[model samples]
Target: MSKVFAKRLFDGESWLTNQQVTLSGNVIESIMTVEVPSADAQSVDVLAPGFIDVHVNGGGGALFNHTPTLAALQRMVEVHAQYGTVAMMPTLISDDYEIMSQAHQTVCQALTENMGGILGLHYEGPYLNPVRKGVHNESKLRKPTEGKLADLLDVCRLSKLMVTLAPEQVPEDFIEWLTAEGAIVCIGHSAATYDQARQAVESGAKGFTHLFNAMTPLVSREPGVVGAALQTDKPTWCGLIADGHHVHPATMRVAIAAKGCEHMLLVTDAIQSVGSDEKEMAFLGKKVLRSNGRVTTEDGTLAGSDLDMATAVRNTVSLIGRTEAEALQMASLRPAEFLGIDKEFGRIKVGYRGSLVALTDDFFVEATWIDGQKVWG
Candidate 1:
């Protein structure tokens, strides 16, 4: 068994002290919180579950929009690993049907070769409200036609397909249909009214993608998509970008108050610009202007985020008024649970996968492991 020891550890719920965890292959075989490190253990600091980012556009100067080759996948995965992101769903923005199809094939190929970190494909566009589409090219937005989506996922042979659609545009029945096919339907890039958004949720829209940004706002009479997403009784996981830019600090508080931390998943929603020190770059077929850790266009619409998974953890904690343990949950265990992957990925408990990250006191991931294998930088 391979073992890791940490001075502090997050056990998926709360912070604990003096953790010594042993793993064999992918599963954690044993866990003990004791004073001394195990004889067979490699010691680290603040060991936590490896982060699971449900939305990542690109990293390491490569983007899914530009070219989604397997090599590009490897690059992003490596860069994200440095920040403790272990498993991630490669996100592709709204694009032509042909480009999306190729992305699906890319996911299938990644899966076939045991590219373990590639969870699935996230289609963030093509069925969205053009009125609320942010960086998504409005020209490529399409109405949901009968069987078009199923055909796309099938062609790509994708097991998990997360689609973010504007409830204002797509029919309610499509939400039911997509959910029935095991495709996670998320509401995002939308101008969906309250009733429309609620109907989508009722029809099996399980999540809200990058909530509060590019979505309808809460109103007195209208309530809007943001309002619908904040309803706690609803079983939807509200995905937050948490960059301190996409949603304001006060608004972030409201989201946390409305939806409990468990009901929220933190995602970078990062485009190709994340993790790159490169000053000049082109993204989404246009120039990306970056200054002081902010990535945006000259017009000031957020292109994506320079914030990686680790920084996301820090930023979320600052906004939520919660402990580091709680914020980390949004980045790790909670997201894994939202994806129904908690059994294997979210914790350092027995029988769980050894997807762990060692973070500094400031929450920077120093090293990452997927299963028991180190994802070296």
Candidate 2:
């Protein structure tokens, strides 16, 4: 068992001060407020539930599409750990079947080995709409065939799966099939109308890949995918790239105001340049440049991002005018809830995993712990 003492602890819902959290093995055992700190407790300024990112393309000077190996995945995990990401879905962009198969195998291998910070996989797709492909390979974009769907479903048994697809590209019951298979279905890279997007959510699509990017825009007469995202009474969550480049601060404020912070999630959408000081990296045979806190191609096409999870949480407070607790919730609790792993993964409550991060007063990550063991500092 282990004990952690933080000046403040964000226990998934709200902040508690001067508390001691006990952990046994990988799960939290108990938490209690203390007037005098425990003698053996590890102390920190602020402790929070480790960030759970659902839309990570690449990091640590390695792009998953390029390497698709366990070593590459481990490097991504170690690099992102420094930024306080305890768990992530190593996302693969639109690629051929062979590469996708390799990625699936690699994630399975990581899970089999019980690798820390490897939480299944995310395929951001070969089944996306070509019109809004963004940095994805348009040549690889295609509808899901029965064989391909079966192959993907097979991999879901090895680990959790989050598949991002265009509602317009796949068959009528595609989203339902994915949901039934226990994979989280996210709608993205589409040009779907509002009704179509809403229907997909009604059909079991639980989230949007990255809101307000590469998807259809909201028009006064015709409410598009963005409109469906902003609507109420639907349980769909929208993942927002909070790097301040993919979205304007004013626009992010509007989204939080409309949908409320409960439905808004913070995602890095980070690419290879995130961990290293490199200014350039290759993506799908195209050169990507990192500048002014954004990554873009020569023609000014936004590839992914240089943002990290800790930075995204900080931006949520500074740029979006939200509380630190709310910002932390978007990065951790909400994403876990969206993935249906909240009961075990998203809190400092009893029985939850002892995955947590310590941040300084300015929100910089001071250290990180996964399963009660320190991983990065």
Candidate 3:
């Protein structure tokens, strides 16, 4: 067993001070108020549940699409861990069947090895709509076939799979079928109408990817995908890229107000430039550049992002005017709930996993722990 002393701690739901958290193996063993600081306890300024990123394309100079290998995935985990991301779903943008199969096999191997910080695979799609294929290769976009669907089902069987597609572009029963097979279906990169979005949710689409960007906007007359995401009464999650480039602060504020913070989570939608010194990288045979906190193609198409989870949590506070605890929850707890791993990974309770992060006063990550083992500092 191990013990760490937290000067201030956010235990998922509320904040507490001067607490000692004990861990046994990979799980939190106990937590108690510390009337007096123990000299043996490892001290931290601020500790909270580790951030869970559902959408990550690359980091540490590795792009999952470019190099669908175990080494590349490990590099990503190392880079994001410095930013307090204890778990992530490595995302592959629209790609061919061969590359998709390769990526899937790589993730399976990682899972089999019990690699730290690798939660699953997020196939962000070959099944997306071509119209809103931002940075995704248009040539790779296609309708899902029986063979592809079968492969995806196998992926769900092996690990947690999150598939993103356009509701209107897919068959009426595609979302239902995938969800039934244990895949978390999400809507993105489409011009689906409000009704279409609603129907997709009713049919088992659990979330919206990158909430506003690459999706139909909310208009006065016709509520588009954004409208449906905000107005849906079901327990659906919406991923907001709090990077400031993908969404305006005011717009994000309104969306959070409408959807409520419990249903609103943050995603980086990050690419290779994140957590690396590289200012330029290749994306689907095209050159992409990172500058002034934004990553974009030469033609001014917004690619993914250079954002990290720590900065995302910081932005939720500074940009969106949310409390620090709320911002931390969006980064950790809410995403865990969205992925249906909340009971084990989202909190600092005694029975939960000992995945946690400590941050400085500026919200920069000081240390990160995944399953009771310190991974970064």
Q: Model 3, stretches more than 4 Å misplaced? A: none
Q: Give the Cα-based TM-score of candidate 1 against the true structure.
A: 0.96
TM-score of each: 0.96, 0.97, 0.98
Provide backbone clash counts, one per model: 0, 0, 0
Name the weakest run of 10 consecutive residues (lDDT summed) in model 1: 150-159
The prediction achieving the highest TM-score against the true structure is 3
- Over 4 Å off in model 2, which ranges? none
Task: Pick out the ten consecutive residues of candidate 2 with the lowest summed lDDT.
Answer: 146-155
Candidate 1, overall lDDT? 0.83
lDDT leader: 3
Ranking by lDDT: 3, 2, 1
**What tens digits encode model 2's per-residue C-alpha lDDT throughout 126-151?**
88998999987789999898676677
> What does candidate 2 score in Cα RMSD to the true structure?
1.2
Q: Is candidate 1 or 3 superior in lDDT? A: 3
lDDT of 2: 0.89
Candidate 1: count the clashes. 0
What lDDT tens digits, residue by residue, belong to model 1 across residues 247-349?
8878888778778888888899876677777876887777888887778877877887787888888887776577787788898888887777888878878
